[model samples]
Target: MRPDEILIIDRDTVERCLAKQDPVALVESMLHHHAAGGTVLPAEGYLAWRNGVGAYTRAIAMLGGSDTSSGRTYGMKLINASVSNPGLGIERAGGFTVLFDPETARPTALVEAGFISAERTAAYTMSTLRVLGPAGFDEVSIVGCGTIARAHVRLLHRYFGAVRRIHVHDIDPERARRFASDVTGRFPEYTVDIHPDVHSCVSASQVLVTLTVSDEPYIEAGSLRPGTFVAHVSLDDLRPEVFEHAQAVYVDDLGLVCDNPRRILGALIRDGRVAVPGTSDAPGSGPGRAITGAYGDVLRGALPAVRPDDGFVVSNPFGMAVADVVMGRAVADLARAEGLGVMVDLLGAATRAGGAA
Candidate 1:
């Protein structure tokens, strides 16, 4: 409560926190955090950029019921925000946030779902990139320019060093050029160029990053150069056949992807256009099991990268609330230890409520 108390957290500080966490560990941490009676709030929001043609705002929340006795917390998370990210080439405006707390707990500090959204979303992307090997990227293509896309460019540079010749593209040409100029003016090590067309960028990029809000697909397999890899940050960026002949379907979790893969894969399996590699025992089944056995197998070096002829390579991640809970709790602890967050006067309130349970 004293003026001497300070809350020291800046973008750089958050970046440091994020830099230290790995994607696999982040995912595992979420699983553990959930197993440790943690929770994730809900997320809902929209996206609109460069034009008044699109705009939306909505409310979304989550409820967490933690059972310390059983050492587990069973809960649900949902999105109520409907605004899509402006149709920037690389960002799809998505903003539905969830707040989490113990089964019988009082609120002392309320974290802004907006910041949490950016934090966790970046965590997932960086986590995957970290796992995939940061140096794997030699040339990078960012198709959309927005908050998250900017975050990607900044963080990737911070983590992997300047991507050789950064390529920027978007439906908004002016926005794309501005993004180049702004980011170039900000970080001088990399040369930023604005591409008037997606094809030129995609064809030359080895590591392509796309974030878009358009319901229509922004990426097409026909354009990707051979041997190039992609890190798709947006959940709904591709169409049905984008992965029609992918050599590898990399994912953070095989089970999660299997349960609810992207619309492209989800629709293909559901409509019989394509089959999930591992689950099909149906007539058209060709392989003995799925392409990659699972995350464990991939970790154990069992799953090989898709060969050149396979056509496409992909990475899918469906974030877990439990992971959000862990990072959130860690941030909360950091806030507490540093006397950062707003403190509540619990005092004898618990005593008045018949003491602590």
Candidate 2:
């Protein structure tokens, strides 16, 4: 590729490239970089509007830069999420990432980000699971059967090794059954059961992951067994009372949790139901109160492990923008190495023709 040209990688290429990448390692490294404080990550930019069909649509622009082994890499992702796009028979999420030449501020490549988002999101959960999950879980339950659920199912198995049983439940039974069948076919050694109801699916499992889009909570506070590790992959699936059941609660970003539009945890805290670790209100609170901190603290050894007797461990992660940029850099490098995208001088040609006017 020419120095002034930019590579354009489509979604299929990104999917193919990511399949060969180790998501865990990539995200782990990204988190470490994030925690180590060298990366430049600005607050994400977001906008919401109504589409032609009156369906809600959202767009996100996340930007970040960090020094890599090769050099400093910067990237920004533009993501559009059409909440009701299922009516149109296409995936609801789509986006593209632009990696830049740090010194020249020239575009390096534009790669699709839908798969990257899914993989990195799952990777973030896996990283937290490694730090906060119980020593071992015999049976795990997944409460959603969508894109995030599939990523979680595959990564949990790949990273944690085999489990005895994986119970899956979805509002749509057909989706649950289909997910169960597909996972069963792929991993015959583990039992993949499809549950018709949420309570039964979550009640006895040692680990439970909720990945639904429910605006209201469905998982009761007392549904999970003691010592269960819960990954709140989606924000609204669990009720506020669920915090009272957590022995420890970890979040990716405390600020985001306390202020985002879907500030479920923040609402609970304001109601005096949830107690953060360092807060004055936390002390003297009764059992089932949460001791909250960032997962990075756990990784950095600033926070101790959740004891086996800690009752229930929960983590709610509001993903970081640094992750998307880091992943984009990796994809850009891979595309360059494999010669996998189209090259074009997006603005250089026009600028050169325009001269100094």
Q: How does residue 6 of candidate 2 score in lDDT?
A: 76
Could you tell me which 10 consecutive residues in candidate 2 have the lowest summed lDDT?
348-357
Q: What are the per-residue Cα lDDT tens digits for candidate 1 across 1-357?
A: 222222223344344444554533544455334433353334422232333645554443344433232243333233334344444443332322222333433332333333444556655565555545324565688888767677776667665764657888888787787788888788887788788888887776767777665555767778887666666666666654555555666555444455553344544455554555555633332222233323333444555534333255666554444454444444544555544433333442211111212
lDDT, model 2:
0.76
In candidate 2, how many clashes are counted?
A: 0
Maximum-lDDT candidate: 2
Tens-digit lDDT track for model 2 on 229-252? 888888688777677767778886
Number of backbone collisions per candidate, in order?
35, 0
User: What range of 10 consecutive residues in model 1 has the weakest lDDT sum?
Assistant: 348-357
Q: Show pairs that collide, candidate 2.
A: none
State each model's CA lDDT, in order.
Answer: 0.52, 0.76
The residue ranges of model 1 lying beyond 4 angstroms of the native Cα positions read: 1-28, 31-108, 133-135, 253-262, 281-311, 344-357
TM-scores for all candidates: the values are 0.69, 0.87
